[model samples]
Target: MVGKCPSCGEWNTYVEEIVRKEPSNRRAMGGLETPKAKPLSLSEIEPGEEERIDMHDEELNRVLGGGLVPGSLVLIGGEPGIGKSTLVLQTVLRMPERKILYISGEESARQLKLRADRLGQISNDCLIVCETSLEQIYVHIKNTNPDLVIIDSIQTISTESLESSPGSVAQVRECSAAILRFAKETHTPVLLIGHINKEGSIAGPKVLEHIVDTVLQFEGDQHYMYRILRSIKNRFGSTAELGIYEMRQDGLRQVSNPSELLLNQDHEGMSGVAIASAIEGVRPFLIETQALVSSAVYGNPQRSATGFDIRRMNMLLAVLEKRVGFKLAQKDVFLNIAGG
Candidate 1:
C-alpha cells in the first residue's frame, strides 16, 4: 500500500512537480566561455603571496589570517542580534580608501543610516542599497564597480528563475552559486551574512558552506558583553585563528588582549582561583580556572563543572584520592573556567 515514504518515513509529506527545461534568454554573467583548459608545470606557476585587502580591524584581520583575499566569497553566520551586521558595516566604514557596496535585504536605508550614524564613522566611498532581487543586485554591482560587496543576509535574497520562496534550500543554493560566480569573474570579494538554525548551524543546505571560500562564525551569549569570531573554514588561511570583540554602544570594539579582559583582578587572593596558560594557534594567553571544595549537604556528593571537561575533572579527583591521600570522596567539588 502507498502510505508513507519509506525513505523519509512521513505520511502525506511528498509532492511532485513537473520541471520543464527551458532555453535561457538571459545572457551569461561571464561572456560565453571559449578558452580551453591546459596543465601547467610547478615551475611555470607563479610563487607569490595572495593579495588581500586590510579590513582595518585588527581582531577581524587576525581571524581572517591576515585580511580579505581577492575574489573570495566569505560567509559570516550568527544568531539573531549577534552584531554580525555591525561588525561588517564598521569594517567597511573604516576602509575609507576602498569603495564598498552594502546591500541589505532585511533592513531599510534609513535604518542602516541610523546605525552608521551611531557608529560615528563616515566614508564617502561607501554606498548603501536595500534590495532583495539577485538580478537587480548584480545590475547595481555592475554600475557601482565597488571594491567590496556586502550582502546583509543571503537567505533574504531570491532569483527570478526560482518559483520557490527565498530562504528555501533551492533558492539559497542557486542565489549563492550566482554570487560566487560573480565574485570569481569580477575579482571582487563578497561578504554574505547568514542566519543560524536552532541547531546552531548556518541556516541553509550544507552545500552553502561548501560554496564559500571562508566561513566565519560569530558566537557569544547576548547577556554577555563579549563576542567571539571564529573561523570555521578558510581556503587561504589557517582555521585555528579566532578574534574577540566587546559589544559597546558605538560599535564592536576589538579586544586586543582577551586574557586581560577575561580575567578578574578582584579574585587575586581567592583560594579557589588559579591562572593557566594556553595557546591557540601561535598566540599564548592566560585563562582563569576556579575550583570550589565544600562538604556535601545532601546524602550524595554532587560534582559539577562548567566549561571544564567533566571526565578530566573526575580523573583529577581520582588522582587526589589515590595519590594525594585526600579524604575527598565524600566531599563536593565544583570546577569552572572563567570567561569561557
Candidate 2:
C-alpha cells in the first residue's frame, strides 16, 4: 500500500525503493475476481481519430501536428505585447464552428470584443469569461462544456484555496496543477496563456511547465510585425514544431512560407548576412542570421540581439578566433533574425 506524503501531499512519495523481506512465496495475492476478462478485440476497438480542432490556418494546423488532439493541455507563453493572447484569440475566432471558451484575467469581455471587432471575423459560439478563481472557472466550464478553452495568462488566475496572491509562485503553480488535473480527467483540451519573464522564459515556477502536456513559447519583437510560436514540450507531437505569424489589422496571419519572411529579400550580398538551416520539430527551416562585428568603443562590450541568442553569439565568436584565427574578442557582435 502507498500513501500521500504528509510534507507535500504528493502520492507515492514513500515508494518501496527496496524489496521487503517477506515469507517465501506467501501465497501470491490475486485480484478479488476469479479471472480477469480478455482484452478487447481489434474489431471492437474504434478507428479514426476525433475531428481535429480546426484553426482554419494550414501552417498552424501543421505545427500542431495535424490539428489539436482532444484532451491535450497546451501552455502558451510569451512576452507582454508579443501577441500571445491575440494569436490564440485569432485561432479560436477563426474557428467559427468550434465551441470555444475564452477566459481572460488581463482584459475584460468588452476589451476582447473590441479586439475581435478589429480582427473583422469572429465566431458567435466563442464564450468569454473574465474571472480569476479556479473554482468559479470550473463551474463556468462545466456549464459551457466547450470544445476548446483558452485561459488568458495562467499567472493571473488564482484558486480560492490558495492563500497567496494571484501571480505569485504558489498561486500560479497551484492553479495550473488543478487545471491540468481537471483537463486530463475531463478529456477537455485546454490552452493556457502565460506571461514571460524579462529573462525570456515563461514566468512562474518551472514546475508549471511540467504539469502541462505541451509548452509553447510565443516569441518575437514588438517592433516587428512577426511572431513565432516554438514548442518547448509536446507530449502529443514533435517538440520542434514552430509556427510563424504576421500581426496585422485583421488579426495575426499565418506565414505559409516562413523562409520568405525570415530571410533578407534585399540582401545585395551583405557582408554579415548568413543563412543557415535550423531543424524545428520534424521540419528543417532556412533562416537568415545577421551578425555585426564592430569595434567596441565602450569599456564594456555590449551584446545586443533581435531573435538570436547573446550567449551563443559570444561562444561563436570565441570559436571563430580559436578555430578560424579571426581575432574578434574586443569587438561587439550584434545578431538579428534579419527580416520578418
Best by TM-score: 1
Residue pairs with backbone overlap in model 1: none
lDDT of each: 0.89, 0.79
Runs in model 1 deviating more than 4 A are: 1-44, 322-325
Candidate 2 stretches with Cα past 4 Å from truth are 1-51, 268-278, 282-284, 289-337
Local accuracy of candidate 2 as per-residue lDDT tens digits, 47-121: 986566767877667667778878788888887787877788877887877789999988999999999988886
Tens digit per residue, CA lDDT, model 1, 1-340: 4579989899987777789987342443422222333899999999999998999988888888899998999999999999999999999999999999999999999999899999998888999999999888877887888999999899999988889999999999999998887788668999999999999999999999999999999999765789999999999988988799999999998888889765787896679998888887767778998899899999998899987788999999999999999888889999988886
Q: Relative to the unseen true structure, what is the C-alpha lDDT of residue 93 in candidate 1, on a scale of 0 to 100?
A: 97
- Residue 5, candidate 2: how far off, in angstroms? 34
TM accuracy, model 1:
0.87
